[model samples]
Every structure is written in structure tokens, then in C-alpha cells.
Target: MHKPLLVPEFLDRARTHYGDSEAVIATTGERFTYDELGERADRFSAALQERGIEKGDRVAVLDPNTHYHLEAAYGIMQTGAIHTPLNYRLTPDDFAYILSDADVDAIYADYEYAENIEAVRDDVPTETFITNDVDAVEGEWESFDAVLEDAGTEYDRPEMDEDEIITINYTSGTTGDPKGVCRTHRGETIHAYLTVAHQEISDDDVYLWTLPMFHANGWGHIFAVTGIGATHVCTRGIDAAEIFETVREEHVSYMCGAPTVLNMLVDYYIEHEPETTGDAPVRLATAGSAPPEATIRTVEDEFGWYLKHVYGATETGPLITTSDAGRLFEADSDDRFRIKKRQGLAFLGTEIRVVDEDGNDIPRDDETLGEVVVRGNQIMEKYWGKPDATEEAFTDRIEGYYHTGDLATIDEHGMIAIQDRKKDIIISGGENISSIELEDTLFDHPEVSDVAVIPAPSEKWGETPKAFVVPTSGDPDEPGVSEEDLVAFTRDNLAGYKTVHRIEFVAELPTTATGKVQKYELREEEWEDEDQMVGQG
Candidate 1:
């Protein structure tokens, strides 16, 4: 007997085992038990069937980290349809491109983004629109709540295979056109199991939804938490004040956020004291561009929160590696922070490798740089509607491993430290430089709050490294220091070519909703169709 591990199936199991247990807490002040969630999922599944959405259909969702977004995800999955979550911050053109590219059959959008989706509705292949807000929806879009109102609570579950596509996660394309990464039932199910094991989440834990649900299924925590019968406390947006309130009000024990989010919380704790019950410290799992060592210390010492760092991509089940630095460096505080900066080793059930340009394995000396590659069940099935791209992504840049496009080195301790993306590496005046390295060094400066490094057009040196900076404590309008002063500061710390040549002070750098800086956005404008494309002959 063969059966798929669609997420909706897990809902049924929870209903049978913990029907009365609290499953979710919405920022809107609504709570749902496991049984109630199951019934709503069934009703929504039935509604999808009525709209002619069935097995293998693609339904899109455009919303924040809300309860309805969660329900729509499971409901769409229940019909054996693919759940495609879009970055709500994307421009209308971005929205139009993805909607048409996926040929979505339907959309369940929040009221806030209803207009953006509606503007592109005509061009998109989708035939239905289910707004998240029922009362205030305008235009011809139907209400998502109303769709479930009269729908029967009983519906037939679709028969799906383990290999069937379950979700389409659109990667934040910092390099080129955004490609939708297709994930399968088997891939996600196994990922959920792995996340639980890696995070060590327990039934007594109260999981806080601080990260966006649109982000790789909230790093697959939504499913992992449900699988463990943990309670969910959802927040609408990432506000330092709101998050502090929720942490205390909901007794949030477990949460996950990017370094930026953690930094914000730590900053708030230092500047503004928030009332807390002091029951127990919260545990946080952080990744996305190895957090600064300062952040690691503040989160552990000041906020009284334990920090665990994990690394992955939208393609690799997004949980490929987690640092157990806590176990190895618990005794030495300084060593612990140093070890925490590395991406760490691969998780159980996954394999990783680093190889040279000639497809040879790089020595694990922690100095010889090579491309980081991996092969595992957790890898995406393929890029949706992109056969050539899929084939290219899987090529053996390494001997027989799927090229990850990331450059890294493994230490003797079996820990992998990601250096930078091969494409993002910079070469100035014949000197090769890791942009990430320069960025990290610059980040250590007290004046630099946020920084991104990119190649700028230079007549003499071909392409020189330029930095866009956000100041931590200074008049951002004046940048408080001259370019010469910054260059002097870098020269004290970094090599000659790696010094920041040009500095532009901005209030903030543009970032993906997940807090990843859109460096390519910075790149395009910096080059701006220049005659000699960066470092070209």
C-alpha cells in the first residue's frame, strides 16, 4: 500500500490524537483547535472542488503570516493541488510575471494585496480570486471566508503520490529572473520531520510565528510544530514592540527569525525594557547570511534567549545544516561564538561536498575555497516550468554532486563555512575578494548597521568594490564620515583591494521580505547599462 504524505493528512492525524488541543493563535485574536482546523480545511477543500480546482492544480496565496494563509495552504494541499506562496512585497510586475508563469488556477489573497492581484488578474491564467477578508473585499473577487461558509464539511481527499508536487516556492532572485522551485509531498514531509529533530521542538513548546509563512513554509516550521502538537502564536508583522508583547502575552517559547529580526529584538531589549513574566527564556533558530558574532552574543547574554543557527536554500528543504556549536563550545564563550558563525555540517539524511573548478574534491583545510554542492532527497524536484534551468542547476560542477552555486570550505572539525556565492565574489585590480568577507568586516564597525558590497564601475581598476551602508549611530543624512575616513577604517582591518572604494549612505537597504538584501537590485542600478559592463575588456 502506497500513500502520499500531503500536509492535510497530518491534520487528520492531529484531529484524531489531539482534537481538543489548541492549534493556532492568530494576530486577529482568533484561536483554532486541531479539530476546528480540520473541519475548516475540509470545508475549504470542498470549496476548491466547487471552483473546479482539483488534483495537480496550482493555487496561489498572497498574504502575510496569518491564520487564513495557513488554512489556505493546507486546504489547497488537501485537494492535491499545489500551494504557491508569493512575496507580498513584490511589485505588480513581479506579481504578474509569477502568476502568469505558474498558470495558477486560483488565488487566496489578503485584503491589503487584493488590489495588486486584481490589477494583474486579467493577464493571469487563474479563474478564481478568494480574498482573505470577507467583509471589505471589493471588485469581482470572491471572499475566501464566504467560499467556506456554505461548503460542506465533508470532502473526499485526493489520491496523490509521494512524488507529486505540493508547493511552489518562488526564490528571491538576486541573480536573474525568479524561478519557482517545486517541492513534493515526500520532500516537504521528510523536511518537517527533519526540522523537528534538528530544532528539538517538544509538545510543551509554544511556537511563535514571527517569520513570514510565505518563506519556505516558514522554514517548514508550520508543519513541524503541528506534527509535534505544539501551540502556534501568529503575528501580523515584525514589529519590535509587537513581538515583545506577544512573547510575553502568548508565552512564546520557540520561535525562528532571520538575523535582522533577531537584531531588532536585541536592540529593543537594550534600549526599551519590556515587561516579561520571566517564566523561561525563549529559544530561537536563526539563519540567512550567517549572523554577526555580536548578534550571537547579545541574543544569548542580553535577551536571555538560546540561539541555534541553521543553513539551507528554498531548494534544499531549507534545513540542510544546523550548527550544534552549543554542544561543542559550551565551555568557551569566545570559541562558541566563532563556531556559531559557520554554516556547520550537513543535517542527518543529507550529504554535502565542496569541489574545485576541475570537479575535484577540495581539501577540508578550512582555507582552500570551493563551490558547496549537495545531493539529497530534500533537494527540490525541479524548477517549475524550467527544464533547462533545472538541468543546469543539477550539473556536476563537482564530481557527482548537484552544484549549490555557493562557495565554502569545510574545516577539520567537519564544519562547513559558507564564504560567498560564486557569482557574488568580486575582483578588483586583479585581486579576488569575497564580498561576504568584506561585508562581514564592515559590519563589525560600530558605525555600520547594515552593509552590502557590490562591484562598481572603475576606469583604472576595471571594477572596484563599492559599499552601501546604513549607520547604527550617526546622522544618516551626513553619513557622519567621509569616504576617505571609511577607506582608512577598512585599511586598518582589511586588505587594499577589499577596502570599500565608494560609500553611499542610505536610510536602509532594500530587502526581500525575509530580510535578504537585494544586492542585484543594487547591482543593476550601479552599472545602469554602463558602456563597459563591470570589469569587462
Candidate 2:
């Protein structure tokens, strides 16, 4: 007999085994056990069905890392609707594009961000708008609690296949226009299994929501942690001091973040020198960019927490490899730092290879740079509504592998070290910012004649977008536009995080013989002192 792997079973199993056990400790300081959370999810499912959300309908969640996100997501999936979670940091215009592209049927936004969605409501196909605090939010929105209460805790669960698409996570990445990455029940299920094994999630573990839930579904932690019956301690946003305090107060055992987050904690530790942990042991898994060797050492040696450096993209489950192998190096040896810096061996059931332009495997000399390609069950199924893009991503270098535009070197142990990016993407502070996107925005400025945006190493943000602008004045020293003005211009036009952090006036950008602007020259100049062009810690 064949059995299907449905994601809702994760909650079902918890309710069966640990129903009376605490499941979620919300940002509001409210707690819910597995049975209670299950009921809430059931009611939400009933409400969505009542609102005409049928099988395959897209339902969007625009909330922070709260208990509501979990309930809403499960609810959407329970009715067999696709769970599409948008980045909360995106602008109203961004939401408008995603909502229209996904053809979203309904949305459950946090009170704080509902206005952003409401601003573009008429432009999108989404008709139903629900928020946690309807009274606090302006305009028309049903209260989430009220809707669940009104609807009984019963709804028909459509027949599901493991291959059925259940979630769409949009990546507003190198292309500027966000492409919805479709994930299947099988892929997400396999990803959760792999995440639990690689990240070592446990039943008694107290997991903190330091990472955003919308991000690759919190890098698949929402499923991995819940499936493991771990306690969730939710937070509205990250505060280094508050995180440390939560570690003590809630006995948080495990969390995840990017290199930027690791740096923030280290900075806070150095400045304030607070107690690092509670009775429970702490482990942090970081991935957006590789952490510097120093930061890893500080986290392991000073903070008394284990740091697991990982590597992946939005399409590749964001957890294909981890640098947490302990058998390779001595326990206390300093050599562990170097080993831990590289994105370590591939997880079980995942195959990672560094291939050249000819699609041939590069030698494992730890020096030859090649594009990283992956083939795994955990990888996304395809880009929603973008067949050509999906086909190109899979067929670019090899027939069946997803070619990651990251340039890396593989060692004898098959450990990969990311060095540079082959794509025109700037990963600043763990967020993907397209160089062309920033360049296009800057080119729109009246005072700007020409512009090239590149990644500049930052101590705080790891990598920040730096623009080299040739002002209409044409003189490098006498460029009419001030740096402050350009920075503010970007903030006004785009999301706040995508703002250009630094601007340098240049006489002219370096160009190829055919007159194409050479962005590598600008990148080389910006990252002269760094070993890798990407963020380090």
C-alpha cells in the first residue's frame, strides 16, 4: 500500500502524541498546545473554505514570525490551497505585482502590513483580507479570531498527492521581478526530514523564531521544528539583546540566522557583555552568506553555542549543505574553524557538484572556481507561472541539475567554499538585491548620467550595494548629485533595505571594447582586501 506524505500530518501527529504539550509561545506571550493549535487551524480551514477557497487556490500570508503565520499556512494547505508567503519588507508595489501574478484569492496580513496590501487591493485579484487585529488596521479586513470563531472546526480536506504543489515562495532576486518558487508536498516533506537531521532538531528543544517565517518558509524550520514537537518561541522582530534575553527566559535551544545576524549578536555581545545562554544549550544555523572564521570561533568559543554554517538559494531548499561535521576535525583544535568556514558536505539524498562552463566537474583542489549545481529531492519543483525561466534554471549547465550562479571551490572532502557570484546579484545583509535593479533605479535619477552598482564589503552588513555614478556633470570631483541625495533617492524608490549604502562619483565606468559596462572592475575595486566577493560574517 502506498501512503501519501501530506504536510498537515505533521500537525496531526503532534496533536496525537503531544496534544497537551506546548506548541507555540506567540509574540503576544500567549501559548497554545498542539490540540488547541490544531483546533485553531481547523477553524481557519473552515473559514477559507467558506470564503470559496477551493483546491489549488492561492492564499497569501503577510505576517511576521507569529503563531498566526503557522495557523494560517496550515489552514490554507488544509483546504488544499497553495500557501504563498510574501516578504513583509517588500513595498506596496511589490505586493501588487506578486498578488496579481499569483492570482491570490485571499490574504491574512498582520495589522501593521495590512495597509500596504490594502493600498494595492484594487489592483490585485485577492478579494478576502484578514488580519490579526482588524480594529487596529484601517480599511476593510475581517478579524482573524472572529473568522475562526464564526466558522466551525470542520472542513473537507481534498485528496492530496505528494507531488502536488502546496507552497509558492517568491524570490525578488537577480531579475528584480519576483518569481514565485513553487514547492511540492514531497519536496517540503523531504526538506523537513533533511533539516531535522542536519540541524539536529529535537522534541524537547525550544526553538526561537529569529529567522523570518516567510523566508524559504523560515528555511523550512516551521515544518522541521513542528514535526519534531519542539516548542516555538515567537518574536515580532529580532533584537540582539532581546534574543539573548529570550535564550535565558524561554530556554531557547535552537535558532537560525544569516551571517549578518551572527555579526549583530557578536557586536551586541562585545558592546554589552551580557550572559550568553541559559540552562538549555544553544545552536545557530546560518546560511545567507558564509560567516567569517573569526565569527564562527567567537560563537563556538566565547558564546558557548554551536554554529552551523550552511549554503543554499531559495530554489534549493536553502539547506542543501551544512558545515557541522565533527568527525573531520579534532574537537578543540583550531583547525575546525577553517573546516567550518566552508559549506561542508552535502546532506543525505542531495548531490552537490562544482562544474565548469562546459558542464564538467571541477577538480577538488580547493582552488578551482566553478558554478555550484545541485540535484536533490528538497529542491523546488519550478517557478510558478514562469515555464521558460524554470526550464532555463534547470538546463543552464546540466540537464537535470539546478545551476546555482554561485562560484565556489570544492576540496578533497567535497566541501565547497563559496568565493564569488556569477550572477548580477548583490546579497546585502542576507537579502538578495539585484545590481541591475539598483542600477535601473539610479539611472532614472535626473542628475545621474550613468551608473554601475556592485557589492562592497561591510563590517556590519557583510555586503552592501555600492553605486559608481557618473553624474550629468561628467566630472568625477564636481559631480552635481551628492552621495546623500542618491542614497535617499534609492530609499524613496525601493524598499528601505535595498537602499544604496555608498555612492562614489566616477568620471566614467570601465567598458568592454564593444561598450558594455564592466561591473567586475567596480566589484574588484570594492573587494580588493577580501578573499571572497560575497559577504564574510
User: Which one is best on TM-score?
Assistant: 1
- Candidate 2's C-alpha runs over 4 A off are 424-537
Q: TM-scores, in order shown?
A: 0.95, 0.81
**Clashes per candidate, residues 3 or more apart or on different chains:** 0, 0
**What is residue 513's positional error in candidate 1, in angstroms?**
0.6
lDDT, candidate 1, 1-537, per-residue tens: 866576766676777888899998987898999888877888888999888998988999999888888788888898899999999898778888998888899999999888888787778888988987756666787877778898888777877888889999998766567899999988898898888888888877888887788988889986888877888887777898888788787788888888778767766776787763246468888888888888888777767777789998888888888786566786446788888878997888889888898878799899889988887777899999999988888885743456778888898867898888776777677776777777778777767777888888888977888889887753578766666877788888887668878888888777878877777788888888797445331
What does candidate 2's lDDT look like per residue over 1-537, in tens digits? 978888888888888989999999988889999999999999999999999999999999998889999999889988899999988877899999999999999999999899999899999999999999988888999999999999999899999999999999998543458899999999999999999999889899999998888988988988888888889899888789999999999988999876556766876787788888999999988876556566787799999999888888889987899888898899899999888877889999999999999899999999787899999999999999999999999999888999888888899999998765665566777887756557757866767766777888888877888999877666889888789999999999999989998999987777521123556667766788888867431
Name the runs in model 1 displaced over 4 angstroms. 1-4, 275-278, 478-482, 532-537
Scanning candidate 1 in windows of ten residues, the lowest lDDT window is 528-537
Candidate 2 structure lDDT: 0.86
